[model samples]
Target: LDGRTVLVTGGAGFIGSHLVDALCEGCDVRVLDDLSTGRRDHVHPEATLFEGDLCDEGVLDAATEDVDVVFHEAANASVARSVAAPRASHRTNATGTLAVLEAARRADARVVAASSTAIYGDPTTVPVTESEPTTPLSPYGVEKLAADHYVRLYADLYGLDTVALRYFNVYGPRQACTDYSSVITTFLEQACSGQPITVEGDGDQRRDFVHVRDVVSANLLAATTDRVGEAYNVGTGDSVSVAELAALVVELTGARSDVVSVDPRPGDITVSRADISKARAELGYEPSVSLREGLTQLVVGD
Candidate 1:
């Protein structure tokens, strides 16, 4: 990737910032973010930052100019928030993505779009695969599915090289506490701050937690691979319940806060896991971070 001109849309956010870090040294990186959820401080100084929305054609043209590869990572990622504010969800997650695709087509840049497992929407089967029927429950899922379609359509219609990565329960450092914050981030913050953590609906919902670092690796692979008009799952191929995660957090952080049960949030899935066989075979992507080790790292600041 040395000497390549790269653009990351949400480069100020968690996983996007990590992608920027990896691409900054070897390439000329440019970041375009609206600063709605992403922080300005997370971006590196060496990389240029463009403050604007993806729907802004001027911003898109400026950011996509002379770019070789585009990582379209910006989206409204919260399921519950989407349930409450469906229009805003579609605006940013769906239309915003279309705008990005149009810009990529004009600039003739390869794209790696960051998608979500929410597209599966309460999978009836365990370890959901890309072939599973998509029946998204929330507006967020609908928006994601729309964006995924747009990306693939651009690849086929415009002959653009594009790949979509569906990340499951991504968590790690730099994750802020917000409405769409992961359960892991919420629990860690509460436990470390000596506050009780709330677990909704008995905390028995199973989830496949993949670390953010692994997602970054998958994005890098997507950029280099010659694959186009394809979507791959990025996950650890394992499962853990929210109750188990909370218990582990308490044990690791030694927080005195008790785990309390609460009413479940709407649009929350009961169970989720990923079937990552395709990504492994094609991209040689294997998640190196274990849940225990990842939690320990957060506690010890390693």
Candidate 2:
């Protein structure tokens, strides 16, 4: 990616910032983020940061101009938040993505999208594959599904080089530990602060918690890989129950916090794991950091 110009949408946010940190090292990087959830400080100083909404035509124009690649990470990522507000999510996740595709088309740049495993909803099969049926049970899932289609549609219609990555439960440092954040972030926050680690439902719900760094690697790979018009599932190909994850966080943080059971909220999935065979074979992607290692680093770093 050296000497190539790149655009990272939402490059001030958790996942996007990580991409910026890597891309800015070799590429002339430009970032477009509204800062609704992203922080200006998170963006690398070397990259050009454009603060504006994706709905603005000028902002999207500036972002994609002369770009070699477009990494579309900006989205309303929370399922619960999407449930509370569907239209807004649709506008951003679906419409915003379409606008980005059009911008990339004009720039003649390859596109790499940060999609989600949520499109799988409650998969009937464990270790869901890319071939699995997309049964989005929530508004967020539906929005992502719609966006995923746009990526494929643009690629087929306009010969746009594109790859969509369906990421599993990604967590790491810099992730917000709020109610809308990932469960790992929330659990770690509670454990560190001595707050009761609330377990929704029976704490039996499983997730394939992939590290943010792994996700970053996959995005970069997708950007440069010759594989176009394809969407690969990004995950560790492992599953851990929420109870086990909470216990691990408690152990790592060494906080005097107790795990408590609670009722499950809406938009909850029973289990999730990814079959990353395609990514490994095609992208040479490997999960280097184990859950324990990643959690330890995140907890001890702060």
Cα RMSDs, all models: 1.1, 1.1
259-296 per-residue lDDT for model 2 (tens digits): 99988877678889999999999998898879999999
Q: Give the TM-score of candidate 1.
A: 0.97
Which clashing pairs does model 2 show? none
- Give the Å shift of residue 295 in candidate 1: 1.2
> lDDT scores for all predictions?
0.90, 0.90
For candidate 1, lDDT tens digit of each residue in 91-171? 999999999988988999999999889888889888899898899888988999999888889888889999999998898
Error of 1 at 163 (Å): 0.3
lDDT of candidate 2 vs native?
A: 0.90
Model 2 stretches astray by more than 4 angstroms: 179-181
Candidate 2 lands at a TM-score of 0.98
